[model samples]
Target: MAPDYTLDRNDELLIAVSLFEYSREWEIAEPWNAERAWFLCRVICERHGLSPSEAVLELE
Candidate 1:
């Protein structure tokens, strides 16, 4: 079973930034996907109660 809740693009960027900055382990790799990053960011924030970035998402 996976965790609940979904994340928008802004949310995803937040996670990518977090992982890239904090988790050096993930940064070694070159070029990361925004979608994957968003998923990670969402999970991390959800677990740590870290709110997503105020940045809004413009869905296409």
Candidate 2:
């Protein structure tokens, strides 16, 4: 089930910025875009209470 939650704008922005920085650091350290993408997708899904597939759809 999808989450009933909606992050405030501030929280959303913070998560986005943190994810950006984490993604950059992960790429620099490991250069694994595919793995990073999946990891990020999972994190986003978990945070928002969506399944990975659902999260991907909503993201698109």
Candidate 3:
């Protein structure tokens, strides 16, 4: 099933920034999209058994 959370532009940017800091792969890419950030967020949430909001908090 898909995640129950919806991220706004600020949340998407926050996720993108976190991804950039946490992953060299994303760093090399530089610019990140909401789609990619959302996908990554879902992956993280699923891997850690967290909700999307919790994942963002944890990432922060």
Task: Give the per-residue lDDT digits (tens) of candidate 1, residues 1-60.
Answer: 989978865565555456534444454463355446556655755564444442222211
User: Could you tell me which residue pairs clash in candidate 2?
Assistant: none
**TM-score of each model, paired residue for residue:** 0.35, 0.40, 0.38
lDDT of 3 by residue, 1-60 (tens): 997998765566466446534554544454455446556766655665666666556555
lDDT of 2: 0.58
Superior candidate under TM-score, 1 versus 3 = 3
User: Best TM-score goes to which candidate?
Assistant: 2
Q: Alpha-carbon error at 25 in model 2, in Å?
A: 0.8
Where is model 2 more than 4 Å wrong at Cα? Answer: 1-5, 30-60
Error of 3 at 37 (Å): 1.0
| Candidate no. 3 TM-score | 0.38
Error of 1 at 54 (Å): 7.8
